[model samples]
Target: MSTLRPGRRFRTALRLAGIAAAFAAPPLAAGAVHFSRIAPLTGYAPAPAFDAPDIDVPFDPGKRTAVVVMSNTGTELTDFLAPYEVLAATGAFNVLAVAPEARITPLGAGLDIVPHLSFAGYDARIGADPDVLVVPFINDWRGAANRPVVAWIKAHAGPGTTLLTICGGAVTLAETGLLDGRRATTYWDFFAWVPRAYPAVQWVQGQRFVDDGNIVSSAGIANGIPATLHVVEKILGKAVALETARKVGYAPVAQLADPRFTLGMSPLPAVLLANAFRFDKTEMGVVLHDGVGEIDLAAVLDTYPRSGTTLTRLVADTRRVVRSRHGLFLVPRWDFASAPRLDRVVVPGARGALDDAPLAAWARDRHGVGVTYLRGDLGAPLAADRFPFDLTLADLARGESAAVARWSARGLEYTPEDPAVLAGAGWPIGIVVWPMALGLLGVALGTLGVRAVRTRA
Candidate 1:
């Protein structure tokens, strides 16, 4: 008998591995998947009436101080930005995005933010506890890296400060033990894990937010919008909160959430896995500039990359950091003069109309890339619901595939009411089917080639 050549053996192994990978990808993407034995508990809990304590330390008397904490490791994009932007829009508070350090804090999905002040810097600058402290989901909440952040939160949990946690941020706050025995809510997906991890806190569901006096916790992602608006209503008054909601184009805050947010077996895992294995990815550039709306920016930065078919890079005229409308500092990944070739460019909503003529001219003239405005202009809301996530889904539906948009929404734990958003589009069966088909073909061809060689031998 003759031995198979090294090259032939390697090729055969490669073909077999490819076939195995096609079958293995989805489960790998799902990541130690487990199903809940019982349906998630759901119900609404009203915000209790409680008087906010006056600030004990000295602060600017002219405006109330609000600090949105950032974790240098990784923070959720919408979780951090929505509350910061909404609160800043009220103009009742001097909002600041403070972090554990002054480094570039990377947000989940993609995008880097520079915190306005370090924890010590905040101490020196304000020298007082904040009137409102917003905590977004930190990627390393339980790890040692998060210890300093937890410590800072504990130090700042003053009698006057109202602690607000967005999404899994409840877990981060729970780490500080302040949420012990408090009625709190978090992202619906965490229904299984959060309670098991921290049984001390009373976790509530079916509510957009639960306001247990000083500690307020909200449901996942976009739910932060209504929860922040609720905080506004509590502090600033209903009229002011209503105006803020109107400006953002979001509806009035509803006490009861649609209780349908529980998790189960979804096509999302498979869709995401297929997209992840895709070779061709669109290189997209998001224009960054001074006074850009955080909500609009977050919507674009956070949403597009989730499709798993796009990679986003921040583009600006200069590489220098630009201050967002609400005062959060964002670092640009590329300057127009030196940016690489891009497939497309996105302009997020801003406080006012940005003169994008130069950027547009550069993108078109240099790389033949077209620019799409997330919001037509500052006057119009990004979407009917005014949710950044919705704007992203709409953009994906129009620019990519409606199927991709729906799949992205499912992954993000959102359900759209309007069927038309995903209408006329079906799953990209090609992503999975074609790969598996090709792998099987390769395997059969390899087997035939091996059998022919053996016969000759």
Candidate 2:
């Protein structure tokens, strides 16, 4: 199980594309339109059955999930622990804490969590099959020259068992050849090295997570929780994942990157003006510019906390860790006013100074509009009167908000009781995007060719 080469990466991507096409359509005449209207402006038409009867998977609570923990540092501990706590709370499956050995492994800061089983001690005795395996990314990701974990995965992980990794763990996955030909993602920091180090892994940069059948790779660190919750949503149901998050007080920032940060300091109106002129698409990318800070997000989940030591490091240093390891992009929440660039912006709050003279003039000049006000605590209110295409992190979290339901591009169908509800019902769209998607591969390759020819000429 060595890493895949570039040629294999291309072929594997095609195979995955075929699977996606199969999942997207139903068996029917080539040009049948069942669910939605289609004008068929393009003469060439290929529309199988897109909306098939929903498939419901039966839930078996007795199933067990094995989580691999790192003894190195605490960076990955929170990502591991948060999801572990949230998932274990469900009692749907037993979670085993494993490390290199059965000794006490030091996690974030001075906190040491003892491993239940050592990798060596881990016998197939736990069960003939593993429901899922979680790998944490803690150390210098790219510098990982030797990958013992990958060898272990090749030996242990099977088709029925899901191999999941977060952030740096994706690097290890690359070595195992599991993700070699699949679309996957890690922390934003590793985006550059993915193609260079293991070009076989089709990297989708902006995606929060990639689900290639049994393999699930999430963005980074904390994002692993949401990605795992997505699994719970798929397996048990949406309502269950929502309850788990609510139980943990974890409000999912469903969008990839907060849009506010991306909009920069430009007046909201100016930002919206630019976005209005941008071309339309089958799926629009939602970016939350100003993501949340660690403490702020932790505070939302801090129900019965103990030491300030872990909390302090998580908020202050973790921010730096994310930046150093990744970049400014890791901030859990960001200020939209500080975005570096803004083609167009959607101003949610109209009452703010963003409505002032300078901001007003900027919006007027750009022709941006005040769409609707989004509340951070409650969630985005769906205005039967008006619904904007751009929804914020806060907007998507409202579990029962009618504005969210009615205005939902694809209305929220999952109830609070269902365990399979998508993360704010946005994952299907997110998965389709698959992080730096190559849907436009031909255009990209052609552009690169033109540039090469021009340079040589």
Candidate 3:
């Protein structure tokens, strides 16, 4: 064998290093982009004001109307559903889900939803000012596409409507200038950015929800339950609110906010980075049917996808839209016959034995996939003083990886009831190790090929 010259050896080594770096850079860059998308570390530009002509909508004499506003592009899953379900369950108000357009609205990390009324539809049909107008976090809140939504909100900002903004929906509400000189709270992730974006609004930290008379704002996703219940108590009475809370299996807290939620440097960033960079992921199918519990569905759809190991799809027997228990319209993505082969099937809601058996059988017989339930006979009961999100976390810990469960909790800024479930969970070693191993192998192969070419020359 002819030994290489010193210059040739040095050049070969440089080529190998370059090959390794080329193999590694794409994934690293992509992971960083993915992480930034989820947790925005950058500053936000101020929201622009959209001038909307005031439309005098007459108030209905019969019952107070509540409209949960939806955007055609995307809305946060839990923020939209939890409040809608809780309010509808009380049966004290005429709760309606309205969208900017009549088209299907995609929810962030969940199924597509069809709102009951479009802005035009609501104007033509109800022709009444909503007593409560709920603004959920939408994907394109600051973009030009959201001008119509901003204008509609601004027009309805009179003293007659109670404006409730859930999570980052506070940003949207702030766009309407309603929260100016009002105490408001939002998702903890926004603490750094939103205040700078809207300095006119007094932003409160460590609060689950804030009520400055007509304008109300909730801290984050799961907190929507307690905040909405608080609204129920304000409108109906403590008795009705308590009953509604009991029905939903939620225990109300006396404190204005939980001090546990805040942002800082922690293992969460590393964990998020690992999950985002993970190459091997499972495709999970979620069954959508009529009368599915909105909270249950939201919990599964929101939690599993965040784990970074699972991709969720809304599957149904038919392609038609189905109504949730509280009346949020859900449009299924795939019919069972046409759906891609899935690693597993998730059945959400606390549907009783009669409803669950068919789903389990179909998942088993037709697809040969195992079924996981969000609640009821097959699934664990909601723990005492726990929300549906906690149930989802527990399921993630048990069914998937403990590390993934912790990641989901960290993403939501939620503290789990049992620390034991997430104990010892850390960054996925495979995410780092596998990529390094493959990169080394690629470099070695490239070096061998280069040497062979030199020998032939």
**All candidates' TM-scores?**
0.81, 0.44, 0.81
Q: What is the model-wide C-alpha lDDT for candidate 3?
A: 0.73
Clashes of 3: 0
Question: Can you give the lDDT of residue 48 in candidate 1?
Answer: 19
For residue 18, give model 2's deviation from the true position in Å: 63
Residue 140, model 1, lDDT: 67
Residue pairs whose backbone atoms clash in candidate 3: none
What residue runs in model 1 are displaced by over 4 Å at the alpha carbon?
A: 1-60, 255-265, 350-352, 377-387, 415-417, 449-457
Clashes (candidate 2): 39
Rank candidates, lDDT, best first.
3, 1, 2
Greater-lDDT candidate between 2 and 3: 3
Whole-model alpha-carbon lDDT for candidate 2 = 0.43
**Per-residue CA lDDT of candidate 1, range 86-188, in tens?**
8989888988888887766677544677677889989988878999999998876888878999999999989999999998899999999999999999987
In model 3, the runs with Cα more than 4 Å from the true position are: 1-61, 255-266, 273-277, 351-358, 376-386, 420-429, 442-457
| Model 1 / residue 144 / CA error / Å | 2.5
